[model samples]
Target: MNYRHVYHAGNFADVVKHVALVAILLHLKKKDAGFAVLDSHAGRGVYDLTGEEAARTGEARAGVARLMDLRDEMPPALATYLQLVKEGGPARYPGSPLLAARLLRTQDRLTAIEKHPEEFAALKDALAPYANAAVENGDGYARAVKLLPPPSRRGLVVFDPPFESPDEFETLAQAIRDAVRKFANGIFLIWYPIKSQAAADAFTGEVLAGGVQKALTVDTQISAPEGNLDRAGLLVINPPYGFDVEMYAAAEILAPLLRADIAVKWRAGTP
Candidate 1:
């Protein structure tokens, strides 16, 4: 379940995660008051499919490359995500912070955190064009929580850490609980690998047990869990209204295209 970003850029998991991100941002835009976005564990902003890392996996070819066609009709969320990716130019894939920065309105702001020196440097340069975006080089799990309860009181916390450590699930679960305590009303988009159903369930259950009133999980399994990783999950806490429907639309169109089984389920409060 080692999901390093460069190797799997624009993969099925990223496609689904980013589509949900766009949908949530669109919903946030409905309000005149600007909201903030904190992208914890933000990668190097952009990935190159032509690079050796991506060529080795060729994951983008089977994931996002399959859906790159410009069509007349598509879900708003998917369409927007596709448009942004296309605008990034050929073989270049935008990471969470880049996508969030692109969607930020004039009044909005974004703070992207990366612990790795190389990634943090690249992320800083990548976000240089966006005046609304800021970059931080630090431990995402700890730094992200301290920035909670954003000044606007309206924001999204994107928590998708690289699970390099064996205890990453435990760390993420506790981080979510802490984040919720500080920013209970803020929207949270958390990502995790689904290597074991029981482990994934326990992780999500831990977050919910932290008094998170409303939450939903979007799961995608491209194939049975075998040698290569096939399943992943995105857990959204306090999702906006109609958020699930938008994701469902994206899933219907993506399942066949990506050859993945996608499901959106309410794990806590009613939709």
Candidate 2:
């Protein structure tokens, strides 16, 4: 698997995913008890939108760049996301780990896992400033599962794999199964490309088949795909209360800028 997230770092899908992540983490923080976050397939943590890879695709221009002026009137989730983006500066973007790390409170902890050696090294440096965040080099899926029922007992497991292999969906489904079996109460966020709606739904069904109740899906369709992946979806198992509301609010702001048609649906239990 030679796939890298740098080229597509700050696209429309990423905007939605990261916004949802912020909402979830914020929800987790409301409680006094500590919560953990596992970022599987963690990238280099930070991305340079002006770099060669990002410029080649220019995905950021249509994604986070359009939200540079996001105002305080926006929902807290979007506002927090915008603040983090701004903190990274105009030419840089924060990946999941960096975003998650920055959001971590003293009581909360973050474990970021990356499969690529170089990405893992960069991940370490990116998270070095955060005493609450740890970086690991290994199979993100397996390592994340092994860290199940984290010491905190409550947490979020983020699976944002590259989906480079043919059995990517199957692997993701199994990982979710393992997560549910070991840590059913934990919140799980899984991202996947939607080249085929039917296939994507089937994969979602498989994950729900693992007995994941209270799950919701957030999807964005910027355009009908012509083989360049114009659509992607995120599955949130056990999403926090009002999570849908926050994501929808952020989507409304994002839709016009991206010309995207975003949908939020329940795959299992209701809000």
lDDT of 2 by residue, 155-175 (tens): 899999998998999999998
**What digit string (tens of lDDT, one per residue) describes model 1 on residues 1-271?**
3546898888899899999999999999999999999999999999887789887887788789999774757878899999999998646689999999999999999999998888888899999999999999999989999999899999899999988899999999999999999999999999999999999999998899999899999999996334656999999999999999999888989999999999999999998
- Model 1 lDDT, full chain set: 0.91
- Please report, in order, the local distance difference test score of every candidate based on alpha carbons: 0.91, 0.89
lDDT (Cα, 0-100) at 48 in candidate 1: 88
Off by over 4 Å in 2: 224-226
Q: Quote model 2's TM-score.
A: 0.97
